[model samples]
Target: MKKTVILGTLLLGLALGGNAQTKTPVGSIGKNDPKAKAILDGVSTKLKSLKSLVANFVLKVEGGNSKVTDSQKGTVYVKGQKYKVLMGDREIISDNKTSWTYSKDVNEVQINNVDQSGQSMTPAKLFTNFYDKDYLYRLIGETTEKGKVLQNIELTPVDKSKNIFKAQVDVDKKAQTIVRMKIFEKNGNKMSYEISSIQPNATVADAMFTFDAKKYPGVEVVDLR
Candidate 1:
């Protein structure tokens, strides 16, 4: 489903320390301009303070007759080498090495390595290094970021042919926080997730990031191994 891509990619952006809603203008970077490098350098720094975050997402969809929509509230915990996402009946857990997605409805969990490379907008590894040689970046106009006027940053998939979702990330120059994000699918469906509230360096439970099948009785695992 296109909506799933939007959702998955949105989560991917979280791992990248980038936003998909605000598009930063790239008119300034070209050929061999140093301004381009400067902009990315700033993005690298802004992305470092990010440790843990929790957000609520609202998903809406409408078509001819079948209308599907839902809102998911979840918390994302990231500490040193661990990450966990708890959303309704879906849970994604990773220990900076292995990753797994568990769905309560189906009682199945899919597992994968945390490499996150070339799997779409999921650049979890890139979080530690905000630069992906293939993605392009530039500063757009400033609107409102983290309650202050900051520089807007835009990122585009360099290898468009394999791009997962076109993104626009709004970054607060002063607060160094990503305020809003918009993700557009290659199929023309647009999904936007805004950071209504952001809490940084929040204490995250260590156990939540691990998958303990014993914790959920009868829950099965689907090894995408």
Candidate 2:
């Protein structure tokens, strides 16, 4: 379940940000597919224009047999580099500098400094520009559902050693929003998330991204930094 929360955070970040910068060159593994670029650009433009966003999502984890082993629902709020996520008994709050991960089941909160190097899978990088660096993207296909057309794009990592084998992103062409993302892992596990609903340019307060320990009277705070 910890993995699920971590992946959920990545998806939320990726869904809300745009404009990527990469330290390492994309090299030969990356492709210049115009069709895929156009679709991704549209989604990126739409997300970047939003001042803030609130989204409800459904996450499903599938086993090697292609059976869904676990399913959960969650909510995420994003404003700039800050985000707050709630999934089951866990809540992760980040203000782009510090992060607080609270687990209700354990009655503990873990505090740590945020990763800003842009090399790691931090929420800021994923939301802003992580795709620009290590990914080679191509347009896979297109489909329609509920009268909405969606363009599907597949992204493969430039580094073969990465645990994420491939990432499939579905964008709603008309809405210019990401509707779903499916991540295929090297371990034969599949994780997918669907955006059920979203409110763009939401009025979110900065304090929402910070964890107030005073609210949790008896919770243990573990400062890992």
Per-model lDDT: 0.54, 0.73
Candidate 1, residue 62: how far the Cα is off, in Å: 8.5
Model 2, residue 143: C-alpha shift (Å): 1.0
lDDT of 2 by residue, 88-207 (tens): 999888888888999999899999888767655643444554576778887766666667676677788888887788887877888877787888888888787887888888899998
Superposed by TM-score, candidate 1 places the C-alpha of residue 190 at a distance from the truth, in angstroms, of 1.6
Question: Model 1, residue 146: what's the lDDT?
Answer: 38
The per-residue C-alpha lDDT of model 1 at residue 76 equals 55
List the RMSD of every prediction in angstroms: 5.5, 6.5
Minimum summed lDDT over a 10-residue window in model 2 is located at 13-22
Best by TM-score: 2
